[model samples]
Target: FADLKRDRHDDETINTVFRSVHSIKGGAGAFGHERLQHFSHHYETLLDLIRNGTLPLSEPLIDLIVAAFDTLADHVI
Candidate 1:
């Protein structure tokens, strides 16, 4: 989140976020957390788009992504 706050367009940061979310999705699936898995799948898709240059890193989108991260954290707890 700090990386994103500093520079949402940074490729390294975007890739890191994508990988982390993908790992979370895998763990969620292994643990039978279907809702989390589903959410992370969609979140991963969004990150993928950003990483692939298909989506521009807009401020509103960054806000949404951060909120999604918060949601994922909520689920984990």
Candidate 2:
């Protein structure tokens, strides 16, 4: 995900990162991790915005997502 913040418009980077989070969210929900599911839901929403182009991919946005990912990861662990 560090690679995402480095490039503002790397489409592959965007898709890959979004998929990673979405998959994590889905897996967490399936495993009954409510805290992770809740946190990931918000992250997934942001990723959906980016994936759908509703939110333009930018350094700041990616940085924010990365920070959110850190928080989510902490909770999951």
Per-model TM values vs. the true structure: 0.90, 0.78
**Cα-based lDDT for every prediction:** 0.89, 0.79
Clashes of each: 0, 0
Best candidate according to TM-score: 1
* lDDT of model 2, residue 77: 70
Cα error, residue 57 of model 2, in Å, equals 2.6
Off by over 4 Å in 2: none
Q: Least accurate stretch of 10 residues (summed lDDT) in model 2? A: 2-11
Q: After superposition, how far is residue 59 of candidate 2 from its true place, in Å?
A: 3.2
lDDT per residue for candidate 2 within 1-77, as digits (tens), equals: 86775574566776776777788889998999888877788888888888788988767877798899888777767
lDDT, candidate 1, residue 1?
A: 77
The digit string of per-residue lDDT tens for model 1 on 47-71 reads 9999898998987888899999899
Give residue 52's error in model 1 in angstroms.
0.2
| Residue pairs in candidate 2 whose N, alpha carbon or C atoms collide under 3 angstroms | none
